[model samples]
Target chain A: MPAKKLNLRKRYGLLTRGMGWETTHQKMDDVFPYDSFEGIKITDWDKWEDPFRLTMDAYWKFQAEKEKKLYAVIDSFAQNNGQTNLADASYLSAIKLFITGVTPIEYAAHRGFAHLGRHFRGDGARIACQMQAIDELRHQQTQVHTISHYNKHFNGLHDPFHQFDRVWYLSVPKSFSEDALSSGPFEFITSISFAFEYVLTNLLFVPFMSGAAYNGDMATVTFGFSAQSDESRHMTLGLEIIKFMLEQHEDNLPIVQRWMDKHFWRAYRLLALVAAMQDYMLTNSPMSWKEAWDVYFVENGGALFEDLSRYGLKMPKYHELATAEADHISHQIWSVFCSLGNATGFHTFLPTEEKMAWLSEKYPDTFDQYYRPRFEYWHQQQKDGTFEFQKGLPQLCQVCQIPMVFTEVQTDPMQISYRVTEHGGDKYHFCSDGCKDIFEHEPEKYVQAWLPVHQIYQGNCGGPTLPEVLEWYKFTPEDIGNYIGSQDHARWQEWTGEDKEVKQA
Target chain B: MSDKKNTVFLILQDNDDARPIIESVEQDNPEATIQYQPGMVRMEAAGRLVVNRETVEENLGREWDVQELHLNLISLAGNVDEDDEKFELAWN
Candidate 1:
């Protein structure tokens, strides 16, 4: 005798619905609460479809298989001394940024999804979030395991979890993820799942994964492919939630649209680091930041929004500004990072001739005409034994908490964009209109931002001197300074028998 | 097929994982024409090209997720209308 066969449609409904009994002793709000804070009315929760149609048995089976294969690759990679196979030692700088900034956010996402899984009203939505929560946790673990191998052979990766909480630059991602974590269930899904995952995830994942493939980092490339397979499911959840909300009630549309506006800009600001890493860090880069942005954002995102317009939702506010800035943002951000290199972990140096040529070719309008001359000046300064690092604290945006480095949209790339507003009799500064709008919407929230640079100036971060600050950041001499003379660079030269002067020239 | 119906196509990396999805598309859209490149398989249909979840699950012999198509998706052209039920590519 064989087990009874059940159709997937029936099984999905039965298994997912489980057995819910309405509480008679307690009010519905008191029992299953946290759904109505944003006034998103839901008349029919059953109409919310489960896209994956995943059950616990299938989930565990597939997840176990993914982990098994990934661990196998990790083992083989370690056996091969995989660190020595990258395109160049400087390539590790991208990984350094990733571990310090992005990996911790994966953990934050895990916590956020867990909260959503527990709190959402819809059973389908709860199951979806729970699966994603587990997926995020898996991502964080695999990322730590994958990058920990590099920490053994590298300088800047040793204290990334600590760095994520305390470092000045890392506060960008820390604050961004914290914002999502602290939001209500509806806002969290709209912000993280819908806006960040749907509209902006490709910008973060594709370049780094493709870069990993090109840079001879088999471990990271393997993990990236595996993570992206899950991300495909995550992307669908994003689309589904937005549609579900819009279809549920007319009032939900405005709320969802406002969330779309707020989170789109927030997610875009976070990816500034990715864009800079893609364009400036990778020695054997696959594509320019502008190219990736155009392909992923302008074309693909444009199409996605067009598809959604039928639901009465519009493209995010300030979208045109974001598209226009793609040509210049990465260059602008890298220039800022280079100017402040001494204060940070991970080495920074002038782009090699080939890289400079690539930048000029890829960004003919901005790189050659505007940004290249500045890099040339920095190189000349380096040649004259007068390497400069930006000193004095830069102002932080109240909402975004990033340094005021962004330029005016559709204008000169050098002039820093700034906006000022008065809330509760205290003036607030923002880097762009997007940040300003966010601050104005919730002045109480933005005012409470834990700005790192401000904390340092207030003598709140470990101490007052450079050594004191570096000690507070747990940075070694090898971790901070020019890449040309860093330990990683020296080891690369020794391993490959390549001359530093020849490579630099 | 109707007038002014341009061919819509999807290119997925040719791999073991994509075989079931390719088969699903082939079965779902009877008129779909598939071509093989060095490491990719491109499928084109005259009006609309669809990859069905039910068909893919049958081919995979297990539960199939519609979003899993992105695992092997290299690139695609035309307006995409996707849900749990199917992934359809068309001009309109």
Candidate 2:
């Protein structure tokens, strides 16, 4: 008779455990110096649970299958001209935003997790991070490959990596990832794995994926399905890391709590871009931003925080503020993009009457009262041939680096909710108290931030003038401005055989 | 089952990959309430929820690793007890 096969538990243990040895040549402390500097006490590295029992062999097999399926679809999407089937060419603006702003973050995550995989003491955690590191790299590659077809038929996707580092608006996501990547291993995991992946991932991934599906972008939808499984593992790892830290030692509670508070706000603020994409960018909207937030964050995140309460962990600070801002952030972000249309890598347009009616239904209290009038006024301005983009750059928050566009949702929707602070006689501005609190905690770190607006003012960008700045950003005339008469708009109309009369009516 | 305080729940992305697991969950937990939302599904039970690997495999028509459930899992409430054969969630 053949010997009984090992079960997954025992198999995982044999594969991953007892891989590390006591070093007589080098002290374990010196080898893993980063584990202790953050003041997290780990009495036993053995207590670190392997969140998922995935071995390297199994991981390779699963990913290979997924890749096979994904590439097949992507090939077909290109062969069949999937771009023409989209709800509208205007939808590509959201995809351009995604590739420019979000895909680079996936690459950043790859680097970040690879760092964690090396620095952590526990074999379990090291293995998990190593797997996740590969997963992130895979996501980055798949995202690029999936969107490359769009790049063939569109503008604004030519120089994502170059633009990610230098563009003013891309700084929001760039700085957010850098903040996590530069932290200690524990804090990096806490900030990205726990706060962003576990607490706020659905807000980012679902909107883009579902938006893709709703708009007839089959290639993107397939990529989403492929990435979904890997995301689940990442999310599980996130939950495990937080629970592991909180349960390991009492001293870690407050430190973890503070990191959670800071990173949650950072992640939420970065998600404002996603909010605009969901609410306005998708031609056939799957759901409103408010609706997605309510379901994903309010209901799902509420359940997560409740379970976490057993470890004396509460919700991230100012979660209520996030809830309040949900009704307004999407509109605010869309308006900001519209105002800076000439400077943006993708086109921005006023929502059609049908979309405004949808927004009014989705946000009855806020939309009709505060945002619709501004859009209408802009539309009229465009019609009268006097439309103008905002020439001066907006003030950026020091901590999140988002332009100071958010308003005091609870008090007055018209008043921009700005906060101020001073360190060493240097004044810094913030979009909200959440950002102010983050900066106040680590004033030294935030002060060194290479703010885009400050850099542009100092003439570090291409030149002093707007045209030079656009040249520096690698923007062609086709890449920036309103969507109506842009090259993308023209091509899409040509492909669909819709004349000016049909499009206007 | 109606008492909110004692309930434990699991939310999964609604898709073809999760259909068999969802069916198995419904079969295993009779007291659970199932909800369908856009792109997701939620299952809530009064005090406990268990996902048996055997049942899922039966529904899937193949061997199913219990860990694969995480692929579709969005969120969950209650303490978790997971192993090779089964996954369970309940308040401690």
Candidate 1 at A102: error in angstroms?
0.6
lDDT of each: 0.81, 0.86
Local accuracy of candidate 2 as per-residue lDDT tens digits, A1-505 = 9999788778778777757666789999998888899999988777777645777777787778778867998999999999898888888898999889988999999999998898899988899999999989998899999899999999998999999999999999999999999989999999888899878877777656767877788887777756766776787788888889988999999999999999999999999999999888888687789998987789778777877888888899999999999999999999999999999999998888888989999999999999999999998998999999998999999999999999999999999998999999999999999999999999999999999989989999999998899999999989999998898988988888873321210
Error of 2 at B77 (Å): 6.9
Clash count for candidate 1 is 0
List model 1 lDDT by residue over A248-325, tens digit each.
898888988899999999999999999988888877677788887886777667766766787889999999998888
| Model 2 spans > 4 angstroms off | A499-505, B1-17, B31-49, B67-81, B88-92
Q: TM-score for each prediction?
A: 0.90, 0.94
**TM-score of the second chain in candidate 2:** 0.92
* Angstrom error at residue A119, model 1: 0.7
lDDT of 1 at A308: 75
Regions more than 4 Å wrong, model 1: A499-505, B1-16, B19-49, B52-92
Which lDDT value does model 1 have at A257?
88
Model 2 score (lDDT): 0.86
Which residue pairs of candidate 1 clash? none
Candidate 2, after superposition: displacement of residue B80 in Å? 5.5
Write down the C-alpha DockQ for each prediction: 0.18, 0.32
